[model samples]
Target: MEKFKNRWEITQNWQLIFPVIGVIALGYSSFKIANAIISKFGIATIVIVSILCFFLLLKFTLFLFKKLENKWILDQKWEMIRVFIVFAITGSSSMFIGRPIIKFVGITKENLNPIVYWFLFIIIGLIFYQILLVFFGWLFGQFQFFWNFEKKMLRRFGLGRFID
Candidate 1:
């Protein structure tokens, strides 16, 4: 508990790259699976797999929420967190995809007011960025706590911090 508190105090930012990498890898895997199944079957297969994956992900998400509640300081609602994740991914990806298309279509200050484009883009990007920062910070901190705790425990048992 003391170690967890100390680590949280020392590093409370987007410091851990592993969790985000893992999540992205999982998402890429899901996309590939969905595409392959869709190709083999049809749009129906894609929809079914997507829905199934969503539910499964939701279940895992809730489990993570519960684990965090038990082990960490944050007491965020699982439903709210889940909704935020969904909205962040959807909104960020849409803007990310749309920005290039808009630019490709020669959207300019004369065509569409620069202020309007900048306002929407900046607002959405900031919102998504803040949400991801909070989520990732909490997740990384939580895992870091357990990881350090395990190391300390093993050292206490004279395991020499490594297994042969």
Candidate 2:
């Protein structure tokens, strides 16, 4: 209980639950997608692929955590988990928001060429990602850091005029 309390101080107690749920949801989604694409490849292949995907996800999560470590308000190593959680939520939110807009605009792969559809999807998703990164950072108690980061990124993209 004491240990849990210490960790929760770095983030809201309920907030910690999100990362666990996010990781499980991501893993399940990946497994389903992989299964759909590789069902004919045999169970051994599926298992191996699933393992590889899990490791890749883990690596990416850690990489994100490491990259954002300096910007996070919490300095403890364990806080990296929280940072990863926030990043996952932000990224998922970006894609979720972008998909609806794309669908509304009737930009499906069936309508547009596959390459064009994906290109537009990524562009739209990236726009949402930039906006959501700061929003999620605020929600997770790192607003100032992300706001500065966003400003820097916008400047890099030649939108420095927008930032006062």
Candidate 3:
């Protein structure tokens, strides 16, 4: 426990939730991917594949952390996990929220051109993602990081005039 806390610079017990949730989310995602890929296999096979995928995903996530550490200004290493969790939640939520919105607006592949429908779906999702990113970041106590990130993204998209 001490080692883990020291590793992530966690001083408060409440701050431990981010790393724990990150691990559970990663494991659940790995298991779901393994099940989706190997649905025909037996339970034993699925477990093995899920374990393998979990390690692979963990390695990939760690690689990303190492790569992003320099680029991201964070108070502690644990905060990165919270930031990632916010991003994950915002992305999935944007698509989930956008689907009902598109349906409400009478924009579906069945009604609109397939290409146009998909384009609109993506655009709407992106818009919601932008809004939710800061919202979730604030909820997760990382508002400054994501707010700055949002401004940088807008700047890259040629919308710096609106940011000030």
- Residue-level lDDT of model 1, residues 16-68, one tens digit each, is 33334445644655666677767678777876786677567757855765676
Q: Write the per-residue lDDT of candidate 2 for residues 24-132, one digit (tens) a residue.
A: 8668766876788799999888877877787787787668767866765665545556556667788989999999999999899888899999999999999999989
Against the unseen true structure, what C-alpha lDDT does each candidate score? 0.53, 0.77, 0.95
Per residue, candidate 3 scores C-alpha lDDT tens digits across 1-164 of 99999988999999988999999999999999999999898889999999999999999999999999989999899999998999899999999999999999999899989999999999999999999999999998899999999999999999999989
lDDT of 1 at 126: 51
Q: How many residue pairs clash in model 3? A: 0
Residue pairs in steric clash, candidate 2? none
lDDT-best of 1 and 3 = 3
What stretches of model 2 exceed 4 Å from their correct place?
1-37, 40-74
**Better structure of 1 and 2 per lDDT:** 2
Order of the predicted models by TM-score, top scorer first: 3, 2, 1
Count the clashes in each prediction.
Answer: 0, 0, 0
Q: For model 1, what is the error of residue 139's alpha carbon versus the real structure, in angstroms, after optimal superposition?
A: 12
- As a whole number from 0 to 100, the lDDT of residue 162 in candidate 2 is 89
Q: Candidate 1 vs candidate 3: which has greater TM-score?
A: 3
